[model samples]
Target chain A: MPYPKVDVDEWRLSVKGCVEEPLHLTYNDLLRLPQITQSVTLECAGNKRALRDPKTRGEQFLLGAISNAVWTGVPLQTILYLAGIRPEAQEIVFQGMDVGFRTDIPDLLSYSRSLPVTKAIHPDTLLALFMNYEPLPAKHGFPVRLVVPGWYAMGSVKWLRRILVIEHPFDGPYQSRDYVLYTRPDDYAHGVPITEIQVNSSIAYPTDQQTVRRGNQYVYGIAWSGSNNVTEIDISTDGGHIWQPADWIDSEQRYTWRRWSFHWKADLPGEYMIMSRASDESGAVQRQQALWNVKGYVNNSIHQVKVYVE
Target chain B: MPYPKVDVDEWRLSVKGCVEEPLHLTYNDLLRLPQITQSVTLECAGNKRALRDPKTRGEQFLLGAISNAVWTGVPLQTILYLAGIRPEAQEIVFQGMDVGFRTDIPDLLSYSRSLPVTKAIHPDTLLALFMNYEPLPAKHGFPVRLVVPGWYAMGSVKWLRRILVIEHPFDGPYQSRDYVLYTRPDDYAHGVPITEIQVNSSIAYPTDQQTVRRGNQYVYGIAWSGSNNVTEIDISTDGGHIWQPADWIDSEQRYTWRRWSFHWKADLPGEYMIMSRASDESGAVQRQQALWNVKGYVNNSIHQVKVYVE
Candidate 1:
């Protein structure tokens, strides 16, 4: 089901959690705060799962989220600060206008979640008023949405309307219910909580992706992760066993993808199996085989591409 | 030196790779092909290169490329089939009219790339004539471009005007001189090759990311990869040490993002780090840190998001 839609004027996010005085801000009201500028990434936690082939297939890269935009808004903590936190206030609840459809086990779903207070006051946390140098898109979240940087997209509440302080986690279908994980292979039981996106890579050229070889050429693509930042990415002209590292350009932001290039002489014509792999500081990297789960979560399989190198 | 802003009548891409006769396709002629439709992703080879922070304290998750659009145009191979291929034809090359600016290099950066004939003929690759149900935007390739599925945006040369075929890889600056991995920290002597983007994930919510308090709320985002299709994405309310899974809703296209949900109770309130990791059937998973290299290429590092548990 789609999130609840509202007229621009009817939209307002209420701040009642752990505060001295409750605060309510309308779409226009959010514009009044001392605007702060921040560049943040909001991503869909679930990425690549099924669909695979060294050649002739859909995109091998993960999906959803991973968008970066400039945000302008007021500090979330400032609002929380004004709403004097009660000593017992342990968490701040966030709710969105999106109401989900009815499910088999539950009556319906309303999108909402919560976080601890300390983070609410972080200097970077803001109620975003702008995106990509423009007002937010309705599809993205118009009016106001909670901005939580350096965190997964989940922290950002869209079509935001209500906020409250509570002593414990809110047991909603989405929170206490969804976003859990089953640790074991056969463990269909969802127990883990949902949050971070993992590091991985894909093959974009001579990509088993299967493209027409019209002439001599070049190839290009992107890579990224959340932990220590991208340090190295390599491509293999002769498949996974042998590989060569690629070049990178330095940048101011570390949460961005590092581009790479591989030279395919393509002089001696033959069928080639191209592949690429990425690794991070945590010593974690892509593998040849994929892990299995009932829901198919965290599929970080290596990428293999094929091309007729003329 | 942009591709000398050619008039639409003058803009055309020549199809010459391994074909019996070289076929030149004008803007109008290219648009005349059976208007095929497919949702494709255009990922900049170097998008989000600035941000990939897990250990460092910089904003990560800048989105570049990896864009989805419903494309319309002639299938690349359709034109190739008309031209007829030479059995010895080893590769297909694509040349573009877009030379937006001059790099430190001498020649204008007229985009160029190639695909083997087999992959180029795949049903999905299109000599794109339209985008998002509309004509091409000037900022984008106005006249025409190649739509190579499951590949980086670079290979889908924009403002395309030429298709060459050579026994060797297209030896243009972009072919090997450019877009190739030229350096690495540990192995400065040798560089990696460019091939594909690794399986990766990014934060799409909390777009203007910052810290947030934990409580009853819903966290949602997207994920994908170029190698394996996203199977499942895991979320971490804490930093990446532990992870939980989320739910995904099917959207229209394959390369497009599928909405996923994660509900957080936020019982623990403190400085909470939120992140997500994705995995694909090929076994490529996300990690907190990415491989460190000289010119960071394909930085598929784990996504780190900082939030506070109240």
Candidate 2:
């Protein structure tokens, strides 16, 4: 069904869910409301898992979907409060505009995600309407969207249309279909619904297979853990035998990656190696090998690369 | 002084801090060592800060030095084995090839930073010598750098030269001079050293004051916080009275901005206002009022823009 021919200036965002008075937000209504801003590290729910094979190619990025951008919108809870929600509303749902292959289901469907009413009403959550001070692009969801910070990108639905307050989880692929993790075969694939992403690190510079000489080389890279920023990063040149530590650039919070570097000299010429590891606020460290899944969602395996030393 | 030009293929990182053995590494040797890749978020020590007023454009962004990149290097500990230093080497000092800065300071001074010896052996650290699957760019410090996961950007020194295991912090401008807060006076009279960034956000698209049309306008922007990953964003249409949440795009780390949108309707004809705010992983959010400081390192104020309603 055709949504409407309304202009964005007079657009009204209807807020209906576990609230008090289903509220309708106008363009001015949104702009006039108090504003909020924060620095967040966003990673695609399916970021960087394709580089495992030698044939992988693109921007040379490891299946990248992680990027940082500023977002503006309204507090979802503020609208929920105005909307007058019923006590039975235990969940909050968001729907987006993109339609892609999402499992055995043939026809494409809009992206959608739902969270417990508790997580939904948190002040940190927003009903996103603007990106980088501009209107949304067609490819990036033009009309409306939901901003759930610290959660997987899946939950922040784009091209959002309606929000429903329910008691159980939604029947969309986001909840029951794709994001679930089953530890054991019979252990029930139903794992903790993906909400906040795990703390992770990456070697941004000096990717695998780089060539180097026997001289001076400074090592550098980034590290971050979704809800919990990076607290530490370690480097190993002799295959983990000896270690060195660089410096931390920021000390605000441990949820973001802090830049670090180490300067070293190579006396003899031969095949050399390089490696870096990181840990987050919760003390979760990057493991040597990440648990493999059919669809590589959280491939937090120890990332290793080879460089030719002549 | 010009440092040695090492061949990328024959380089090996040597870590010789307080470790048991001063290990030696080769380029390939570093790769062969236990390697890990993580999608961590990175935020510049000084990101998002503006001096109010139309003529108040000191610098549009204090948000440089912040970026999320994958790092591949040797664990710092393994390299320390090559030196077999005395246990008293409590400070891990790192120097980089990015020796000279555009500053008025005379002569070339390689950048440097240092950390506690304990952190040097931490497993998540790295002595990175390459960037983005390639050798470090000259602009980004060619030889090597340090990865300190969750600290400030200052710690990641570039164009490495030396690693001194000292008993005290290195006293240098590059290490303690640039990138600091401006508490000396309201206008950076005697700026202090900056250890971290503050909450910050921005509108990447339409930009400030850009006239937008009526119809389904996609509002867009980017947001970020210091070491915390942005977890929430809100938009205001009625000048802060009422607000609506937007759809927040997922990214690789907290340092990057989030792409978000909202569909505004311009059914009626008149002037309109727009604003945005961000919240981080630590639950710290941006306020509407901006603060004044010396260097304007961390300025996270509400971003405002205007549009017309049809």
TM per candidate: 0.50, 0.47
Report lDDT (Cα) of residue B62, candidate 2.
Answer: 30
lDDT tens per residue, model 2, A246-283: 45655645233456766756555554456667777678
Flag regions of model 1 displaced more than 4 Å. A1-5, A52-65, A185-190, A211-219, A250-252, A264-268, A281-283, A289-291, B1-310
For model 1, residues B1-310, the per-residue Cα lDDT tens digits are 4334658876667777567888877777766678788877666656555564321111122565467788888887788888988778778888776564322354546667878776788888888878988888876677887887766666777777788766665666666644566554345346554655566767665432233444575666667766347677888877767789877765434555555778877766555667878776678887666665444456667766555333
True contacts kept of 2: 0.00
How does model 2 score on DockQ? 0.01
Candidate lDDT scores, in order, read 0.65, 0.62
Show how many residue pairs clash in every candidate, following the order shown. 201, 247
Off by over 4 Å in 2: A1-11, A51-63, A100-103, A106-108, A130-144, A184-189, B1-310
- lDDT for B4 in candidate 2 is 50
DockQ of each: 0.03, 0.01
Clash tally for model 1? 201
Best by TM-score: 1
